[model samples]
Target: MMTTAVPAPAISVRGLEKSFDDLRVLRGVDLDIERGSIVALLGSNGAGKTTMVRILATLTRPDAGTVMVDGFDVMTDGANVRECISLTGQFAAVDQILTGRENLKLVAKLRHLDDPGGIADEFLARFDLVDAGSRRVAGYSGGMRRRLDIAMSLVGNPPVIFLDEPTTGLDPEARIEVWTMVQELATRGTTVLLTTQYLEEAEKLADRIAILHEGRIVANGTLAELKELLPPAEVEYVEKQPSLEDIFLALVGKNAPEGELR
Candidate 1:
């Protein structure tokens, strides 16, 4: 008889809670992010989204409960947890004085990866930074620098990655680029903890969604599951009194003369 291997969760949080003085930031929250899955954490401002990311990243300690990443306890095995995880913040943290290639090399050295130059070159090509590899990061555009920051965080080849608003300052095209990178990472068996304000982004990227409100997980499940919790999906057809597109055509002049109606 063959014994099956029981895989561990990439991230597990149980009764996690945090508070600053009398104000609770996370109140007995529970979350489980499976290996290779992208779980989106959604919430409004001051909703404790960043707080949960910080706790899982081992940057800040939770006041109660436990957080385990790759089977290592975040509190007791912080170093081990750090080894298994990479965290990227909302703002890009690229070194302004260092060239893009140099930045990658620095991270490689820090992570003790072999052949820092080769690894840097590989990531440069992968992230579309081959042309900017020798350019000082200070001269790089916002999107380019953001890409470099994410690339640097991948130096350790960690099993889990925490992305706090990964596309915060990007244009739509750049945002899609990040989305593609994230999907590729997940496909390659990287577990991602994604925090975002954009519902459409979460809809596109998340295998599961957890909504935080007043520091607690108010809802959790797949997109359809959460939607079910709110209200049943309904289809309503209304008679169009000259739809918005018709008005736009009247004002802008329909250059195509006729367009296919969806």
Candidate 2:
């Protein structure tokens, strides 16, 4: 008999549960995030999307279930898990008192990254923040601050990044900028786990999507798969006067009959 080795999931949760008093935030949620892929968690308010992200980031502990990040158990090896992950919450965490360059330097120093100055400068150039890097974060615009905050998260070059509503208050342009950065990160083989309320963002970036409804995953699959789970997937027909059927028809002619026009 030969034994096969299983490649570890970038992040994994099994029978995960979390409750605050009578309000259960998560109920036996299970998920596997593969290495170098982006997985988006989607849901309405109070859907436990952020809670699940927190658990994976090791900020919160589950009442029951096992979580592993980069093959380290989050419960017992949290420090190691932290070393393998980076998290940027909904709000930008840049210190207004510090210059953008200073902020990156701080994060680099804290992460014990070699040559903090060089690392900060590299990120400054990479994020196109070089000109603004010398300006105080307080003087920066929302997008600039957000970009700097994201730059800090990359100081250590962690393999897995958890981005929780990263585009929350960003304008459309800023959001698009962030999306490009995310694509670049994924291209470099970094695994990303993102939580977002914006459907477009998930549709555009997620390799897979999991929808949480009332503390449980109501659906999980690739964007196409989840779309298929809805109803009619494809249909072809010709229309001119724009009748109900014509309205239902798509320009591409592939109609997902299962999914509503959302």
Maximum-lDDT candidate:
1
For 7-105, candidate 2 gives per-residue lDDT tens digits of 788988888999998999999888888899999887777889888988988888899999999999999999999998999999999999999999999
Estimate every model's Cα lDDT from 0 to 1.
0.84, 0.83
RMSD of 2: 5.9
For each candidate in turn, the TM-score is 0.87, 0.87
Please identify model 1 stretches exceeding 4 Å from their true place.
1-3, 233-262
Clashing pairs in 1: none
The positional error of residue 132 in candidate 1, measured at the CA in angstroms, is 0.7
For candidate 2, the per-residue lDDT at 46 reads 83
lDDT of 1 by residue, 58-143 (tens): 99999999999999999999999999899999999889999999999999998888999999999999999999999999899878
